[model samples]
Target: MAPATISTPRYLLDQAKRKLTPTPNTIPGMGAVDKRLQEKEWDQFVFAEPPAGSDLKPIMGDSGVPIIGHMIEIFRRGPDYILERYRREGPVYYAESPALSSVLALGPDATQAVFSNRNKDYSQRAWDPVIGPFFEGGLMLLDFEEHMFHRRIMQEAFTRTRLAGYVPHVDSVATKVLANDWVANDPRFLFFPSIKELTLDIASEVFMGHPAGTDKELVTTVNHAFTTTTRAGNAIVRKPVPPLKWWRGIQARKTLENYFLSRIDEKRRSESTDMFSVLCHSADEDGQTFTDAQIVSHMIFLMMAAHDTSTSTMTTMAYHLAANPEWQDRLREESERIGDGPLDIDSLDKLENYDLVINESLRMMTPLPFNFRQAIRDTDLLGYFIPAGTNVVTWPSINHRLPELWTDPEKFDPERFAEPRSEHKKHRYAFAPFGGGAHKCIGMVFGQLEIKTVMHRLLRQYRLELPRPGYQPRYDYGGMPVPIDGMPIVLRPLR
Candidate 1:
């Protein structure tokens, strides 16, 4: 499975190159762009026109080895290597992908510019050509007016009343899933696979109103399709060349879509309280309801978004809790305080300690380390000109570790987030586990409730410990992070 080639048309590349080479022209806000006088500032903007005769340091250490750079190290090493290089080589760093050029940006100012104010300049279109087969017409890939319009319809699924309604569903689903027949004494039982299954079940029951035992095959198909599509998106060549991963991904997506479309007619006819039903009955301001195709596409998108992200966060929290007994003890104590009452929305609010632990886990091991946005126009970012069509990545993994914002940044300290300390308050985007701005994750509240509920039940019944001391989970770089060897833990029943 070769890495996916990210291609930019020659005309677009040429346009970006032109924008990079700024000329001495009078611009309103930026004053006159004097080429000779502002050469230093100009050099910051242009990668091709670096200060004459200066050697470009490798964007990532030893990642230049064939296939290893794109295929392996980037995912395996996580964000530390990139952040280390950024610190050594200044804010904006460049790397070659064999397919296309990539630029990685770090620091609070750069992150804010990319994610907050200048998001319009970036396109999720690059992701579209690959992910489109699976998540077609999803809000993450939509742009401009279409994005906003669809977002409004999707927003209806996450209202306060709707979220409150989901609390019990989350509680019940978590309770049932964690109470599976798996042995409590076994340390080799993989938490990632278990949690993945649990989240998919949760999505089926909570989001789609499917009964606990129903839709097993459909859920399995969707999960396989999502995993395959994400892998295909990262492939260097995506043709259905026999036996290749991309071919399998394409087949998986087709199968999943067929299943979803098949169910849409039935779902549309039977009015219900699920989010899927809401989406089916939902109409835009123009009285437009999603077509069958749109319905299937959006349903797949919602399920993938809901399941994978929550699973990742929960897995990370589990790993951290297993590693730090003190934190686990604190969480258990907090869960005890909340008692064994139903973990409804009101009960979730009382588990403030659970919130801190989850927030801290997200900050330490962010599910999506970097967000990609393509520049739409020539934009000045803190004096650096980011040309249109340039790929701009805001590394949240790096920002989460910034020393200026966090005390003992590398340590797992949930207390730092508690009151009186209030460290994360220093920067609004400091803890962007759910992201920020209008594009923030819509299911964030639901995700938190799900984690707290699951944790509350699990902690009350069992004392979880890792297989070995100082065990760190390895991530599968294909899509969202997953435990490479399955996070092994022993769940000792509380006596």
Candidate 2:
């Protein structure tokens, strides 16, 4: 059976909402969202301009299967499926999913177009299907001026002073996690779950200034909420089907809202150094502040993006280093040269070799595999016409591995990023692990600091090793690409 499609998008979207609408017990204090969902109608927009001229081509590609579309095939084949197709189909091509037909903008050329979305052709709104319900009003979901306005105020939360404050929390937490949480030399210590836990703990501490296990289990609830919401990023079924990922995501959204809203008053009253308090007090020069909605939404997205990417990055660095001990030795040697002391902004930069390895790991794994945008108006990706409302998929994930751009694209080579051998500089958008243009990750600095802080502690203290030296990560690329088995590995103690 095909996944349900909406001919009347507004009406069908409403019906889908009704199916997933929260129950009182399931959603807690989300009666407001329920009210909005029940009463509000989608203000559908259509352009005044006529269709593209006969000269320009329609989007090139394939919409696989009926109903289910490319959903199943994507899961089976992973991103390489699209990569191979891109090689055969050129930089611009079309592909269909259960929800919408989209233009696949591969390689650096089309990728630069979408990321440098100048005329407001692409939108973050298309993500509403995947992330809207969970992270509504999130910075990533807003478009045009509204996105800029919110980003401006939210910028206060990630300022240099704020980031400096966050480093101590990052360093302290990394120490505590390695000491209390990780058992060194465990033959089967899983890297994915362990790193996930560490990053979540780091997220709770560094972002919210809250304890991971304490606060009456605040962190635990937050952890559950992040897991449920992220797991539903591409759930096949949209309905609140019993025992399902989509359903849990809805419930998690409600919990997150309640918890975040409850903290607003307290955060405003006190002067805390955490990002949460910073956001609560954050305002533009015109005295504009995030409504309660924007604060919570931004926090939820920032927390998850930070947690997920940092975890993926650390795990990849660990996996790759374990596989290549010489590279591991090279990095550890630099870490030692920089001293086994706490790293500040200057010291973090001084660990040039460490940065290269981290950069290479990000390139190889490409944490946020694909960044999505929908066309708001007809747009051209390298002369290929993408009609309005088509979901535009751009791949940094696939771009990193393109043979035309990177030398020996599949080899685990960190020196490609080092000194004169800077292969990532071969193309402007060729190595966009953190995305590009105005929509580039706001937390890139913080994410880098967090990754370096954790790895610095671990790398110096241990000679890490994976149980299966040649074990390849089988990525489950739903939202972010994560290893299905949680990346099993064991740590080898240096002392």
Which pairs of residues clash in candidate 2, taking residues 3 or more apart in a chain or in different chains?
2-67, 3-67, 60-93, 60-94, 61-94
Point out the worst 10-residue segment of candidate 1 by lDDT: 11-20
**Global lDDT scores for all candidate models:** 0.70, 0.76
Candidate 1 collision pairs: 3-235, 3-236, 4-234, 4-235, 4-236, 5-236, 121-376, 122-374, 123-374
Candidate 1 error regions (>4 Å): 1-71
| RMSD each, Å | 9.6, 10.1
Question: 448, model 2: CA deviation in Å?
Answer: 0.4
**lDDT tens digits, residues 1-495, model 2?**
111222323212212121122122321233764344334332222212225464555443333443655554456445676786676668876565665556678888888889988787888866777777888877777778898998999888788877877887888888878877887878778889888988988888877788665565565787888888888877887777767888889999888888889888898888988888889888899999877777889988888788988998998999998999898888788888777666676677777777888888988888887877887766667876665666777888888998777889888888888768788888898799988877888889888888888888898777888786567777777777788888877887787
lDDT of 1 by residue, 343-428 (tens): 77887788888888898889887887777666666555555545555666677777788888999899989999999988888787
Clashes of 1: 9
